[model samples]
Target: MIRTSLPLKKSLKPKRCRSCGANFNPISSMSKACSVPCAMALNDAAKAKSAARAAKDERKSLAERKAKLKTRREWIAEAQAAVNKVARLRDLLAGHGCISCGARPQQKFGGTFDAGHYRSVGSAPHMRYYLPAIRGQCVRCNRDLGGSAVNFRKGLVERIGINRVEEIESMQWTAKWSVEYLERLKKVMNKKARRLEKRIEAKSEVNQLEAVE
Candidate 1:
């Protein structure tokens, strides 16, 4: 049931202009702009949005093309570099010095340390990204003397315990790393590295505050 309770309006209510928020009596139901200037503004805004979307698509296409040009080995190396970066930062945060020569990493990642592996990637590619199998080592021991294997063993046993070190030593799987797997690994490690950086920055701020106090 319907009841006529109050007085009626003289005409339909004014519509809000899409471009300018001003209210107007639209010329037609389909009209969105209140005036020619507002119409022009709306058109320009739509065109700019379309252009920006097109630019984003073009950039994404270019990145895909560049990624496609890289070889499987290149992908592997890139993923490995990301893993090493995260591993080095991990050891640095833990206050563990070089696993080989017992030299300390400079308080930062500053090219003085390398993420050395207990089993070289050439020998055990399966453990390439394994955290327990890798440690931060001074550049001198990792690059100059080739991991300093004998010393690294003693250090590895102490850090991860003998059972874990032996488990790594006795592992016997043939790892076939795919480009897809490496790509995923790279993205994950990069994310972790960023988080680690934030943690380090927060710790530094705390230390500074303590010193001031």
Candidate 2:
């Protein structure tokens, strides 16, 4: 038995060198560089790219670890801040007066305005994220005066009606906030705040419009 000659394999299409940008015929399908120097440069480039990618992954992993190390109290605080910011922003946009003291929003006297809870957070941790129970308040009324409960009740009644206020007061509930739940709440509140922020007009723009009028 005799062996016949095999048909010649077709050459692959020319490829551009990754390093020098010149086109060259490759020895095999997987070949990249045209010359030894280009091959070395390409190899160095690949190693550098891999190192950079590894560094990026390490940084991301380190950040995730640091986040995991944060205490539950810190997570709760952050979520609370997000909710508080939205409450204040809601009243600010609506131009509502202070819930505790009838202090006007434009008034210069008073500490910085805050999201005042009608049912104090200390008393009702369950209602911490309750929007209806919270309203705009000055620092003097909210912090310095310890929420001025009687005045807050009256203001809340006037704003939300006696029925709603009473309903909020009558409610008694407990919550077990997990880290995942708190994280989601923070993200949701932040998203709401961002949406509300878009509705706010810049002071300069408002002034210009008023001046034009």
Q: Give the winner by lDDT.
A: 1
Residue 210 in candidate 1, Cα distance off native in Å:
1.5
The segments of candidate 1 whose C-alpha lies over 4 angstroms from its true place after superposition are 1-53, 107-110
Give one digit per residue, the lDDT tens place, for model 1 in 1-213: 898888875565689999989999976778899999999999999999999999999999998898888899999899989999899888877778899778885655468988999999889878888887888989999988988999999999988799988888999887888888988999999999999988888887998999999
For each candidate in the order shown, give its overall lDDT on alpha carbons: 0.88, 0.87
Candidate 2 lDDT, tens digit per residue, 1-213?
A: 899999999999999998999999999999899999999999999999999999999999997898799899999999999998899888877877788776775535543788888887888999988888988888888888988889999999998899999999998999789999998999999999998887765644787899999
lDDT of 1: 0.88
TM-score of each: 0.75, 0.67
Worst 10 residues of 2 by lDDT: 102-111
Pairs of residues at least 3 apart in sequence or in different chains that clash in candidate 2:
none
Query: How many angstroms is residue 128 displaced in model 2 relative to the true structure, after the best TM-score fit?
Result: 0.9
Which lDDT value does model 1 have at 157?
91
Residue 206 error, candidate 1, Å: 1.4
